[model samples]
Target: MSNREGEGKLIQVKGLIKKYGKLTAVNGVNFTVNKGEIFGLLGPNGAGKTTTIEMLVGLRKPDEGSATLGGYDVVTDVGKMKEVMGVQLQATSLFELLTVEELIEMYGSFYKKQVDIEHLIESMMLLEKKSDRVKNLSGGQKQRLAIALALVHDPDVVFLDEPTTGLDPQARRVLWDIILKLKEDGKTIVLTTHYMDEAHVLCDRIAIIDQGEIIALDTPEKLVKLLHSDNAIEFRVIEGELNWNELPNVTKVTKKSNYIYIYSSNLQETLSHLLFICKEKSIIFQDLHIRAATLEDVFISLTGRRLREE
Candidate 1:
């Protein structure tokens, strides 16, 4: 690992490749994350998100290529890199006997620098449960404790893998607020999530990865635009053999039950064409709706399949 002189980017990955025997987990993945930005690495399960992050955190070395965190090569400077990075993996377990505060202190001791435990506890809203053993805490509380352990070192970069998984709505909201607070504190975050809304709300830019490669990388808005499905027209079809392919600006059409969903970039044109077709075919519909396209649509367009399906 080598550092670039006077560079400000917090993370830079160039042509990174990682293999596990016959399988390639991450293949030629390249992207840079600027300082203090929430860069999301998003994909479905088994999309190499975890593999890429493991390499970034120096837990697993790459088979080929280079990745640098804060200008330090991850593989060569594993010790130094670990010191500067705080990580919360998908499954964070703790000794059943350890209290919240004790666990935080234990993790903090590994760092050369000291962190403010009292302040961190207060900020994380763990004061009430600080003395409770790890086994006695709720799922949200455990996740929060894991986050506290990661931050107790005062690292420059933090990686969260599926932080909100298995969390209830209220717990997810609390986690979101905590993430936003981290951003406000000028910490650079690199996270992976299967939630489209989370990526849309939390990340400044996201790379949509799949099949061991980055298929799309951009701001969420730009990604929607690039796919030409930024907005869509959706409604239930009463009955008819409507020629959906003939509709203007209709790039694709999906039919389910009694519903006909149209993917289009020009909403007005598509709606106009759709209405004309419906009238010509004497089709009736109920509960028609129009809305802007989302990251889910972008993912589907790129993969030709839905997120849940993948």
Candidate 2:
């Protein structure tokens, strides 16, 4: 599904702030979500992604600033806001004794209008486990069920916080597909995750938050392009280390253990110079690998830290 013309903004946040005593969790952050677009809050733990989501979803009132969803103020029109939004937090608690279908029905009953239970089950890929007890489901299945509950009311906007956090590779991919389907169905999705690849693949635009502030906001490709280096070369030396900064066309160099990472805008020049230097110095590099710069590299370049580190 696509956003209709003239219906641009679905969610608007301006100077939103949330403080816990002296420590501010969200500090004067501002952004807008276009209708039917997948917007992401990409940050590490304690970066205030959850805090911002809570404030926008009306679970917690912002200490300062304001926000609106679907033309209704989050603070003043919370009752109406709740009716149109669905939220699946990082940790969701469900009755362990309830069957999957029963749990979906229970959540659906809370709304005046509900979607069909079977459709929700099939859409979430939980048909085989529909009659299974909540406790008997796999980690991915449980997460899917939680999302199904959130969509039971056929909400226009969905807020998912780290929806695939603890799942394995297969499960993570499954959830990715489901999220894409939601976007195809024209649901505006707000996702918060530390996984760079997830944000790169799923988000139409991403806001990179760190230490309670938005440091960068753009499409994933544009964000990566901001680094000015499209290629990354990584390798480990057998004995001694060389200063990679002297290399031609190399933009940045970072070293961890015996391994070195070089970012370059011109891949051919950087690789040719590096090969010449290695041969001249008789240095043997091991485990050499080269690939395109990614969202993780962009984050590190901006913050001087990894996404999962701090």
Winner by TM-score:
2
The clash tally of candidate 1 reads 1
What C-alpha lDDT values do all the predictions have?
Answer: 0.86, 0.91
Give the Cα error of residue 208 in candidate 1, in Å.
0.3
Predicted structure with the largest lDDT when compared to the true one: 2
Residue clash pairs of candidate 2? 1-184
lDDT of 1 by residue, 210-290 (tens): 888999999989987865676777788767777776888877776655666688868899898888878877988878989
RMSD of 2: 2.8
Error of 1 at 212 (Å): 0.9
The RMSD of every model to the true structure, in order and in angstroms, is 2.9, 2.8
Cα lDDT, model 1, residue 247: 80
Model 2, runs deviating above 4 Å:
1-7, 236-245, 254-259, 279-287
The regions of model 1 sitting more than 4 angstroms off are 1-6, 234-241, 249-261, 265-269, 279-289
